[model samples]
Target: MTYPSYRNYVREPVIKVAGTGPARSGTEVWAELDRAGRSRSDRPLIVVDCYPGVDLSDLRKVAERHLPDYQVIDVEDAAALPVAEIDAKIADNLTDDRVFGVLGRQTVDDFYDPDALRQVRDQVAGRTTPVVLVGWGALLVGADGGQPAGTGDAVVVLADMPRWEIQQRQRRGAPNWRCDNGAEDNLRKIKRGYFVEWRAADRHKKHRLFDAMDYLLDTTRLAEEAVLITRDSFQAGLTAAAAGPFRLVPFFDPGVWGGNWMSEVIGLPPSDTNYAWCFDGVPEEESLLLDVAGTIVEIPAIDLVLQRPVELLGERTYARFGAEFPIRFDFLDTMDGGNLSLQVHPLTDYIQETFGIPYTQDESYYLLDAEPDAKVYLGVRDDVEPADMMAALRRAEAGAEPFDAEKYINVFDVAKHDHVLIPAGTVHCSGRNSMVLEISATPYIFTFKMWDWGRLGLDGRPRPVHLDHAERNIQWDRRTDWVTQNLVDQVQRTGAGDGWVEERTGLHELEFIEVRRTWFTGPVEHDTAGTVLVLNLVEGAEAVIESPTGAFEPYLVHYAETFIVPASVGRFTVRPSEAAVGQELATLKAYVRGTERAPVGRPVHDTKEPGLS
Candidate 1:
């Protein structure tokens, strides 16, 4: 049962706080609100606006227990639009497609009728007793877009949680905002959140709730306890994180083709099935834990991306992507499980014209572990007719027969450190028993799956196969011979220093990301070169990332964990830790090419060999 499992994976990575020694908790949050109210008018307004998916039951019960004299009002009951009307307004964004939808532009204001909002505001303003306003879109009643009903005697508090947690709740039957979709499919629920609700909520939160809030509450804990921190401390933590190395809190999930690798290595709950994916370096759905004194405050990782875009993503990257983290690192485990779906990604022009996404997903698979007999299905046979292949796929889709993949696909044997370069429009998938370190652009959901091997998903339904999208995007030129020459581990040594050497790995000329692998027995120096760096410890037991001039604290990393170095950190160094003083450690790092030349020129192969039987 011995394997390459690093059981030291951290479930909750945290950053230290500087300005706020200790944050408010349990009863202290209520006491702080009481004190603030005392300083205001005789009847003060306490506006508590929440992000989507926050539970208001605990908030209501706590408010009633502590502030017994105040009148608590839920804004949804007071001013929210009817469910049918809300659906009508968001219909264009939530298209008929179950898994894909248009980007929504509506704000929180669009969810409430004007007359209902005006009535609620007047009622709150004329109240004689102290009032506690709460729930999603609660800030829409404020006079100047974020203030408290045109008054100076009010305190605003924002209750928020990360989107990953929201998805988890959705899987457990939590409905989306203002909808009665409690029993909807989880995939559809996620699509609604991704395209419609999250987009609108993020816009509302950034402009209306980020700075103007007097107190920010962290409601991400399982016990449902609230961790309240001053707005000043929250901003300070984000600024500090952007100036050094940090890891986003990684979240794992199970799938039909999941595996036991992460379950054993990361020490996940045994009650659940195998872990299929780990989003370790994604800023969009992950959260950042800030350690303030002894309490931990969990906020969405996107907060840092929004608040300190230039510092985190660098000036050059910010100008291009505009507040988006362009690179993503994740784990795809098929160890002792099933192969991933046979798939192809859309080309850049196709994605732009059809999906409205500016960039396509061009990815590279760097294997961290693989069985001896493991293989990856890549490219097509050297002489398959496009019309014939399309007809076979349609027949397979109709259950005429199981797709004879071995007859048409090229399977390459994989080893521990092999890097596979897969540009967009190339057919590819990792076969069973391979732990993949998937590095790619951040549009992670743009995959168009072609076949699922006639297997139903974990939900007991047939998985969605995009045969039409796949037929139009797959390239016939990527046959066996050309792929064997261009797509496999095309590594070349770039430089060598004392006890250290660096190699350039190919991600194809069409991709925008550049990757470099460094192996060191001593110290290795690295400069950000004005863009951010996302790296994973692909080899050795442990390593330390340090600052050359003592600029920031030394960060410790383990074997399979991924961490990010912000562009604000100009120079840094990496060396083996004390535990692995003699071991030669290796790290695989990826960053935007930002005016750098591609590692290799485009492939110029056009062979017209006969088809394989």
Candidate 2:
């Protein structure tokens, strides 16, 4: 049957690297932003509204970590506040005669006394305050029930969701946020760049996204699922389902891979795709499932232009490697009747020999939804002799219930806000009725279903089982003794700082290489040793990148700014405006450091040809 077609389903171009071609180092990227900030030191004031939930804190912390001259304060408690509260707070911190830069809030609307907001705006106007307004939905506030429009010398929206109103208004017949089609206009227009579109999939009508999916399949001749549920039904269910103790939100589409329901849920917008959310457990056997594997936005190279404001286009660099990639995922939930097998992922070597797929299972468990009785199977049950284990496996294969399912698998109760890292070679699976946030590597699912209780699918068909492969790859000799017992360490938020708090995993350490929640008042500093530095904003604030060279322009929160710091560029600093205090901000920092390590190469197991690799 012919599938519906889409007009906007364009596959991203592939990225290439060559000798002295397009690839740049992290140091070079950092220097570019540093130069931008430094060149503007002599300008008047550039007032920046540092809204909450933006990444201002990370900018502040980075400044403090490197340059400590600029001061930060709380807006509510500032002394002799100016007509423009944000300006006054920032101005109070300046002791030099240099042109000032302001970073704080802008309150303008009909609710306030007449001329109040105007007076504040007039005071900072034509001064050094070349305002760069930053916040989510700043462009869609009045129309979409958001805060009223705030005045800015130059408005730049920093959203994690699409501006539905503008998209619907501008793109005739478009189902949702089509502003991206004319992304240049969205960035260049006086009112553009005021809204940061999150996952366009979520805000977009399921039908349009589905139409796009059909067009993609027809164009690429690829096999994929139809839209899981029509937009109307899904929206209705979202309202009904979202009211309870547990709600499931669309964060990522899981159907692009093999998983229809048993996959990861995309939380937050596509830009903030790594953020965690939860799915609850089904009672008895209630289920909440979504088909997501089909809608994956795969791009070959991740450039700065992909996430930066249009104004910073020619000047900003995305990464040291000159590439960034994000994976899309979807999930399903069963309230009860949790049935499953004890499965484990193969090592790099096994994947080469058995699956022909070059991937390792590096995922995390983020609880999204959970019932009181929800639990998860992780690791092994108790110590068992190799001979006895083999015999039990044979019995189970032969229809003899030789061992209790729980005896061989460890089950742990789960709750929300908990994050568990699952590295390669780990034996794990989720329990029934429990919804979780699965974060893993770029590749697809590679499971060696070690033990299944001969269960049947919803179609009365026996589900696909993989006992031989499981036996070949299972790390039986190295299996852990308990499940819940392994979770001894709790994830902690590091105090306000510049660098990231590293988490050692697999053969290497993986940490978000940007600033987390915090703020900076003075010059910002960073030493990214040629690795890609990602500033993921979990809070809101504004910042100026300053170095011994000069100062760069300010950016809003909800935006992830990547600056490649090559091995050559040394130390540098970032400066903030006078109204920098009391602003809330957070970010996740990740970078590959220390003794560099290479990935272990293995053979292809799942391929048709054997001797190729």
The residue ranges of model 2 lying beyond 4 angstroms of the native Cα positions read: 1-341, 356-359, 390-403, 452-454, 457-460, 479-613
Model 1, 1-613: lDDT tens per residue? 2576446777788899876746888888888887887787788778888888887766877887888989988888888989899888878777777777667778888888779888888877778888888888887786433345424777888787899999989888889986789799888898888877888888877877886688888988632368888888888889879989999999888887888878777778874567889999999999999988778899999989988988888888888888889899999988898999989999999988777777889998999888887789899998788888878888888999888777777889999999999999999989889899999998888788877889998889888888898988998899999899899979977666578767877678889998888888987777776688899999888888899789889999998999999988877888899987988889998888852222211111212222100
What lDDT is reached at residue 435 by model 2? 51
Model 2, 361-478: lDDT tens digits are 5555544456677666666556656566656776876777744656666667776434454555566766665555454443333556655556643324444456565666655544
Off by over 4 Å in 1: 143-151, 222-224, 595-613
Would you give me the overall lDDT of model 2? 0.32
Local distance difference test values of all predictions, in order: 0.83, 0.32
Candidate 1 lDDT score relative to the true structure:
0.83
Q: Deviation in angstroms for 246 in model 1?
A: 0.5
RMSD to the hidden true structure, all candidates: 5.8, 25.8
lDDT for 456 (candidate 2): 46
